[model samples]
Structures are given as structure tokens and as C-alpha cells.
Target: MEKVRATRYVLPLREGGSMPGLVEADDDGMYVVKFRGAGQGLKVLVAEVVVGLLGRTIGVDVPDLVEIELPPAIARYEADEEVQDLLDASLGSNLGLDFLPGAFGYDGSRVPDAATAQAIVWLDAFTANVDRTWHNPNLLWWHDRLVAIDHGAALYFHHSWPSRAPSPERFAAQRFDASTHVLADVAGTTAVAARHEELAALLTPEVIRGVVEAAPEEWLETTADLPDADAVREAYVACLGARLAAPAAWLPGADR
Candidate 1:
């Protein structure tokens, strides 16, 4: 991922639990910055980078991710107490997604075709992302294309680290219920199953390793069990590898 220093904090996007901010960077580009100090912590940022990279690898349109350096001065000038507090806590590097101008939230009026929907379903299932439902699509229709966003809710298994040893095998066998998925109606089981191999092939072990490595070292939290950043990265690689090697357990409607 590219590194860019945040020049300004434009505004707070008060949508979900963790309020990401819209900011301008030194590269003269605007980004939706996800703070490291947010309630969810560094694991969420790691998920954003890993799943975002995985989505892009499998032909899902996702915004470019960059590491943004946030200096202390940027926080001092904030007028809002809440925003200022967030900035003060997140005084270093944070994850930033290239902001798309004039992008509209996805509505069911312009549904994607079966193939596209299937790919999205497959991606969500593979990652165990439970956030993409009617309540929160986490998709944007920009430039006449469907762009996947906000994958921090995926990879829920990581939240248990330090307390419990990493369990790749358990994650591999986990099941995903697609009934509430935003694209469930359009994403038929047969289509997703048919395209499984093709989509899964894109996420080779080498590619998965690269995606895991893309995460900022500071964001990789060291736990009691996983005592180092490299160990955390290896845990992610192991979980993703295990899931890819055994998709039947998690693939939506695989038995059908």
C-alpha cells in the first residue's frame, strides 16, 4: 500500500459504529480514513487491508488503500470534542481508502448480474463477512460499477486472539448464512459454486501472503499468544489458507 500524510481532516462520516473520517492527503487526493484508535482497534484496520486486497484480486471493485500519517497538530485544531479525541488518540498512521467523489449508496434498483452477484457472495462467504445485509450493504455504486467497501466486520475470528490460540481449522469449517445478505436473491447457489474455483484460484497462497504483509506493522497487534507482528501475520495467512483449501464448509449453499 502507498503511504501518504494526511493534510487535513475534512469531516466525520458518522454512519456506523466506528466513524471514519474524510480527509485530504499530501498526494492531493481525498480519502476516507479509518482511525487506529477507533473502538474496534487495529484488528479492524488489518481486516480492511486484507479483505480489500482479496476483493480486488478476485475482480471485485474496491478503493485503493493507503497508509496515512496523522500528526498531532491535526488533532489540536479540531473543534468537535469527539473528533478531536479520536484524532488525538490516532496520532500516527491509519488506513485510508481513496474517496470517490459523488458516489451514491447502493440501492436494489440497479442490481448486479448473476455472475457479479455470485462473485460478491463467494467473496463474502470466503471471508465470513456478516456485515453486508439489507441494513448495511457496504457497497457503493460509483462510475457505474459496484465497489465493495467496509470489510472491517469480516474475519471475526481474530477478535479472540491472545485469549485463545489461532484456530485456522475452526475458521475453515465455519458456516456462513447468506439469507440476510444484500445480494442473496440474485446470488444463486449454482452460479457461486460454478465460479468458485475460478475466483478462489485468484487468491493463491503467495497472493494471500502479500495481502497480509501489506498491513502496516504497527497495526498488527501483538498478543500474549502471538507475541510478535510476524506471528500475527502468519496467523492471518494460516486462517485464509485453511479457508481456501476447504471451502465447502463455508461456501454458501454448497450442499445444494
Candidate 2:
């Protein structure tokens, strides 16, 4: 794992959802840091780190993410001189990173063409991510590439126990049923299937292992102990393969 220079700075983006801090690191450059506030338990943080690793290994264009070690005193320093100066000069609230300096979305007048849209849909289905939609796309335009952010919802509601009986209400554990609009659109678009197959090779056990190995120690202890890299890869491959083979009438699974 490469060493990243961690600089502590309050983020200017304030989205209503996750309260993530932004950090400019020397290794990965810039990253959105999700704070594990008192309200958030270790599980959520684990989810973020694990999902991020898996997403990146599969060739998904995810933003650089890292765990920020904040001091207890820093919490009360929300009114520090530097922090106050940042808030006053910034256009939006610095409460959290809903917005970033150079980050922007696709033009409202021109949604992604069928190909790109379907690509995203296919990836989301494979990951069981329910957050992507017309509303908060979580898709950003970076250097002419579409990037996904704020994936705090994928694989949600999973059973922590190995022998737990699964139920219909078990949203996270369920496989992707093809009937969903996202799934239908994705399959119908030839571009998506072709791209999916091309990228399939990247989603390997070695890839998953690399991501897990690169993750911070605290992150591992939180999310089901990293699921053996091979197991993780196999699970994703099985889910994606099944989704691809399923009839189009099935509904795509939910993320949260």
C-alpha cells in the first residue's frame, strides 16, 4: 500500500446525506473523508471502506477515499479561526462535503446517452447499489469521465450471521432480479453488456485482495472481516452472472 500524506482540513461541501470531510493527500491527491461521528457506528465506516475498495477494483470510477484520524479536541474547534474563515469565504456551507471546489455534474439538458447510462445501470445492478437514480445521480463529470460518489447504501441490510435464515425483506442479501427499469435498460443497451464483459476480467480475486490489503486496519475490523478476497470476488461474479442470465422481467435488487 502506498503511503498517503494526510492533511486535516474541513470540507466545504454540505450534502444533506453523508457528512464527509475532504482531504488533499499527496499520494491519492484529493479524497472525500467520511467522518465516523458519534451517531455512526463502526459498521457504517466499514461498509464505506470495503465498498470503495471493491468498487475501485472492478474498474468503477470512484473518488479517492480515506479514513481521517481526527482529534477529540478538533470536534470542538468547529469555530476555530481557520475554520471560521473557510466558512465565511466559501459559497456553500462547510458542514460536510456535498460540494467540492471543481466537482460538477452532467448538463441537465443532456442526460448521459444510452450507452453511458446503461453502463452505470449495469454496474449498479452488479453491486446492488440502489442510490443511483434521476434524483441524486451521485454521478459527476471529472476530466470528461463519469465518476460515482456517495455509495454509502450498497449491500445494505446484509445478514451478519453465516446461518441466518434469509427473508423476502432481506434487501441486501437478495440477488438482482431483472425486471427493474435500471436492469431492463442496461440489458437492452448493447453497449452495457459489451462493456461489462470487457471489464469483467478486472474483477478478480487478486484485485479484491489488493483492495482489502490496502485498506486501513480499523476499516477491516468493522465490515465482516473483509470476506476473504477470493470469496468476495466469487460472490460478485456469481451475482453479476446470475443477473445477466435472468429474464428481463425480473426487478433489479435495491442497494439500501
Candidate 3:
């Protein structure tokens, strides 16, 4: 991903807990910036990039991601104490998704077709994303198509790394309940099952490695268990690979 310097802190999108902000970059593009110093920390950002890349790999529409450099001055100009605090903490590089102009939130009325819905469900299930529901779809209707967003909630297994070593097997065996998924009715188990292999094939080891490596090194938090960024990347690759190899464990409604 290309790196762009944030020229201005436009405004905060306060819908979610993290409170991602809108900002203008040196590239003359506006982006919804996810701060590295948010309450969720860097792990959420990692999930966003990884799952986002996976989504794009299998033909799901996602916003273009970029690394946005946040200079301290941007935070200084913010008047709101809360916004200023967040900006002050997020003083370095952060993640940015290209802002889609005139986009509206998904309201279930504008559902994607069976194929697209299947791909989305498959992607969500594969990544163990639970945020896409009636309440918070995290999806956008842009250019008359459904664009996936807010993957920070996916890949929940990583949050445990501070307590224990990265466990690929556990994540692999994790079952995903799609009953409440936003697209469950539209995609159905059959549609998702049928597209499993096709989508999985697109996430080859090389492809997975590329996605994992795409995450900014600073955001790949290092712990005593995972001492370095490369090790953390490997852990992600292993977890994703294990899950892909054992579809019966997580793929909802797959014949075991």
C-alpha cells in the first residue's frame, strides 16, 4: 500500500467506539482514518488490512487502503478534547480507507445478488467477523454496489495474544454462526458452501503472506511470545492457513 501524509483532520465519525476520523491526505484524496492508538489498538488495524485484502482477493468490493502519516500538528489544531486526545495519541502512521463520496449505509433493502452475497458471507465467515448484523452492517452502498468495510471486528483471536501464544488450531476449530449474519438470508448456507473452495483457492499461501506483509510493521505489535513483526505475520498466516485447511471447523453448514 502507498503511504500518504495527512494534511488535515477533517472530522470524526462517531458512530462506533473507535471513532475513526475523516482526513485529507497529501495525495489529494480523502480517507476514513483508523488510528493506531485507538482503544482497540494496532491489532484491529491489522485485522482490517488482512481481511480487507482477503475480501479484494475473492472479488469483494472494499475501499482502497493506504498508510496515512499523521503529524502531531494535525492533532494540535483539533478543538474537541476527546478528538484532540485521540489525535495526540495517534501521532505516527495510521491506516486509511479511501472515502467513497455520496455513499450511504447498507439498510438491507439494497442487498447484493446471490453471488456477491455468497462471496461476502464466505469472506466474513472465513475471517470470523461478527460485526455485520442488522444493527451494524459495516457495509456501504457506493456506486450502486455493496462495499465491505470495518473489518476491525474480525479476526478476534489475535486479541488473546497478550495472554497466550498465537494458536492457529484454536482459531481453525472456531465455529462461525452465520444465523445472524447480515447477508445470511440472502447468501444462505448453500451459496456460501458452494463458493468456499473458489474463495479459499484465491488465498494461497503466497497470497496470504502478501496480505499479512502489507500491514505496516509498526502496527504489528510485538510481544514476548511473538518477539518480532515477522513472527506476528507468521502467526497470522498460520491461523488463516489452518482455518482454510479445516473448513468443517468454521464453515457454517458445511457437511462434516
TM-score-wise, the better of 1 and 2 is 1
Which is better, 1 or 2, measured by lDDT? 1
Runs off by more than 4 Å, candidate 3:
none
Instruction: Assess candidate 1 and give its lDDT.
Output: 0.92
In each prediction, how many residue pairs overlap at the backbone (N, C-alpha, C within less than 3 A)?
0, 13, 0
Q: 34, model 2: CA deviation in Å?
A: 0.3
Q: Which 10-residue window of candidate 3 scores lowest in summed lDDT?
A: 190-199
Q: Which residue ranges in model 1 land beyond 4 Å of their true spot?
A: none
- lDDT score of residue 20 within candidate 1: 95
lDDT of 2 by residue, 57-151 (tens): 66566665544444334434465564444323332111122224476874454455555565556656655677665556677776666666665
TM, every model: 0.98, 0.62, 0.98
lDDT score, residue 200, model 2? 50
Q: What's the CA error at residue 125 for candidate 2, in Å? A: 1.0
- Per-residue lDDT tens digits of candidate 3, residues 106-213? 888777899998999999999999999988988999988899999999999999998899999999999999999989999989779988888899999999999999
Model 3, CA-based lDDT:
0.93
lDDT of 1 by residue, 1-256 (tens): 9999999999999996898999999999999999998999999999999999999898898999999999988876789999999998998999999999998998898998787799888999999999999899999999988999999999999999958999999999999998899999998876787888899999989999999999999998888889999999999999999999987898877763
lDDT of 3 at 171: 95
Model 2 bad stretches (over 4 Å): 1-7, 23-30, 38-40, 80-100, 112-116, 157-173, 177-196, 221-256
Whichever of 2 and 3 has more lDDT, that candidate is 3
lDDT over C-alpha atoms for residue 107 of model 2:
41
